[model samples]
Target chain A: MEKFKKNERVVALIKILSDNPNQVITLNRFSELLNAAKSTISEDISAARKIIECLALGEIETIPGALGGVKYKPILTLEQSLEFLKRLCTELKDPSRIIPGSFIYMSDVLGNADQVATIGRIFASCFKEKNADYIVTIETKGITPAIMTARAMNIPLVIARTGNRVTEGTTISVNYVSGSKKIQTMSVSKRSIKEGSKVILIDDFMKAGSTIKGLKDLMSEFKAEVVGTGVIMSTAEPDHKVIDDYVSLLILNDVDETSKTISIIPGIK
Target chain B: MEKFKKNERVVALIKILSDNPNQVITLNRFSELLNAAKSTISEDISAARKIIECLALGEIETIPGALGGVKYKPILTLEQSLEFLKRLCTELKDPSRIIPGSFIYMSDVLGNADQVATIGRIFASCFKEKNADYIVTIETKGITPAIMTARAMNIPLVIARTGNRVTEGTTISVNYVSGSKKIQTMSVSKRSIKEGSKVILIDDFMKAGSTIKGLKDLMSEFKAEVVGTGVIMSTAEPDHKVIDDYVSLLILNDVDETSKTISIIPGIK
Candidate 1:
């Protein structure tokens, strides 16, 4: 390999660190890869750290002592997060997004890479200190944000399915009444999670919080604990939610079908 | 904002480019954000480009003429890709992964963040030239890889569900035969995809190519063209396949029930 200058080394370092957010990269490894001394690597990291902080991209924390190194944690300021949610509210207010049953068409928003990345960063920032062993979510629409959050948090994603599949091995199933008062069964492969694991649940939308309650029940089967719950949007219709302690990015306050108007506000933590 | 040095600029530039891979970013935008002259921005980009090329991270191409700028395209050399697939094959060979009905339990692999990112990069590199308007996949298991690919390709992800949901306005449904000769129906929201668009189908696994066929059939209903297809794994049992043209990263050659041994190899493009 060719020798690299400090500028080149910094670029490569940023690439690697950003790609594996929340994971520590020891100084020894950087020194070995860049063919530089620990002091040189330290200087490079300091410069990179300063840039990241100045740009408000994220934060780089240094852990001292053996088995210690530096790690990057993505952050979204309150103002930035509020601005994003406001934009999301504007997008959701589109009358065409209104569907039967007063559901907003957010498939496009959920499927967008940029929007998903931003939302994931916000959720990951909120749950960064949970010491979560895994990021859990129900299958389908929630998978995108869950995957993004898992990536940001440097954890594995465990998806619970609506039903059992033959390929999933032995599965644990739990039945919970959905918001619509329908009894729905949710399943997770027994091998997916371990006992005594800490998990954070994420989802695209929460109506009556029935799905989240179902997930909590399913997690209990594996002896796992749901430390936190985050949702992209939650409706206001369900005055009584099954799960009270949770965080939502946006709150769907009201949707007037007759006038084709929808009201939304930033969620309160 | 304070003035940033070359090292800081390069780090920020790399972060922005890597986050939005395959998207052209104008020099003017960088200059404005960095509060630097176009010439200085160009110099910084040149240094960044050199570092990226030297490390074999990816390519930074500069487009000439009006409406032109720099675009980052992630690349994985054949050696790197083969190494990754080989490791994946080794992981899949675990005897305990063999489940009932001769299926392999790979939910863990699909749920893994690092592995999913690598697989997504390989798929994105393969289909980078397809000019796909959307990366499409079925709901559930395939969503992780599909979302990763969409992020890498800088495109929107479109997930087709097993059935229609009231939340998804009008949906188009298509029925296709499964590998076991059973009938299955798949549907996509009418608003999710536009007419006369190009799409690529992705999945976690393929058995007799039934699901890909279903996706292709579903795409036809919307007047969308299936530009390409990619899968993480495909079975060797099916002497004949439903889809003739598709790419698989790994091929499951055999899985012995009695001995609890499995055989796998990298699939040919």
Candidate 2:
């Protein structure tokens, strides 16, 4: 095999590590793939680390010993995350986003791939230390960000449906009252989650946190631990929520249909 | 400004291009970022392209002239895609996957971020040439791969809801008969898709292709053109489908409850 230049080897190394975030890749494997010596691969990783951290791109972690290898951590700094959220707040504050019921229409923002990836990175930064085995969310609105968060963390995602369905095989169902005082049923497959696994719950919006509270109850039935929770938006009013420990990306202060004005800010200072 | 080493520069270039797949980044920008000359950045891009294509990782194409720049295309070769599908088939063939009513429980596979990302890469490779404006799906199961596809293509994602909702603002509703011979209402926010836009429809499963057919009809209402369509799996029983042109990654032949075996294969040879 022809020897690859240092620059070429570094590019390939970064591509693989970034593609599979948080997944370890042993130096022996990289050595075989790049056809380079272990010492040379080590040097490449050192250079990659400097480039990543110096640019504030993220982190490049190297685990030592026989089973250890290199992995990419897409952690964002406080300033970087706040800058992203501030831009999001500006875009979301556009008066045209207000609907008739004084609700802000943010479906487009949530559905955009890169935007959600950034949001997921923020959530991943918050909960990556939890050693979560899965990222959980309900169907419909929450799936996008939850999947992204799961992707960033390199974990499986579990979706809870609003109603029980036969397609999922034997399932466990729980009925809980939503924020509006309406009763709703949520169900998950019996085997979707392993018992005693730690999970991070993610969603797009929260009003009174009733749905999340219900989701927590459902997690309990699975014998899973809710290590952390994150939401994109939460209403400013009703400061006290049904769930006590969860992170919200944005705080939606007001939506005036009549005045066509919206007041929103990043959830974290 | 301080200058960086060649290896460090290539690493940064590869990271940004891979992070935003198919999004163009000009040499001038790279030159500015790395504090290097345009010609130096050009050489770096050439080396990166050779390394990427040499390893069969993907493609790094550089467009010439004033407005042209470099972009990463995560296209999978025939051998690469088939190998991935074959591995998936092995995992999915486990007899334990069969639930009652002869349905295979695949939520775990669908929600696995890395798995879906590969599927999306295949779809993106198939449809990236169509100049699609958005990737569309009808909520729930399809959202994961669809969002991933959209991510790979660097486009927006438009999700059609099951019903008209006030939260999305003024909405457009369409009634379409699904694969199960059930009349279903699917709606998209009027502003979700612009008039005369081009889109690609993606879904998790297609039995009779009724849902996809319905989705195509909904696109007609917006005067949008569906440039392409893709599904992760399609039933082999229905040799004839409502939609004629679509790509399926896997063809689900049968789920024999009595035999405790599943007949499945890669969608394409």
Cα RMSDs of all predictions?
Answer: 1.3, 1.1
Deviating ranges (above 4 Å) for candidate 2:
none
Query: What lDDT tens digits, residue by residue, belong to model 2 across residues A1-269?
Result: 98999989999999999999989999999999999999999999998999999999999988988899999998888899999999999999999998887889999998899999999999999987899998999988899999999999999999999898767999998999976698999999999999999989999999999999999999999899999999999999889898888899999999888888999999976
Worst 10 residues of 1 chain B by lDDT: B176-185
Docking class of 1: high
Model 1, B1-269: lDDT tens digits are 68888888889999889878889999998999898898999999899898888777888989987787898887777777898998888889999999987889999988897789888888988898899999999988888888888888989999998877877799999998866778888889999999999999999989788889899989999899999899998988786888888999998889888989999999953
Interface RMSD of 2: 0.7
The weakest ten consecutive residues by lDDT in model 2 chain A span A162-171
True contacts kept of 2: 0.93
Which pairs, if any, clash in model 2? Answer: none
lDDT of 1 by residue, A134-209 (tens): 9999987888989889888989999998877888999999998876788888899899999999999999999889
Q: How many clashing residue pairs appear in each of the predictions shown? A: 0, 0
Poorest stretch of ten by lDDT in candidate 1 chain A: A1-10
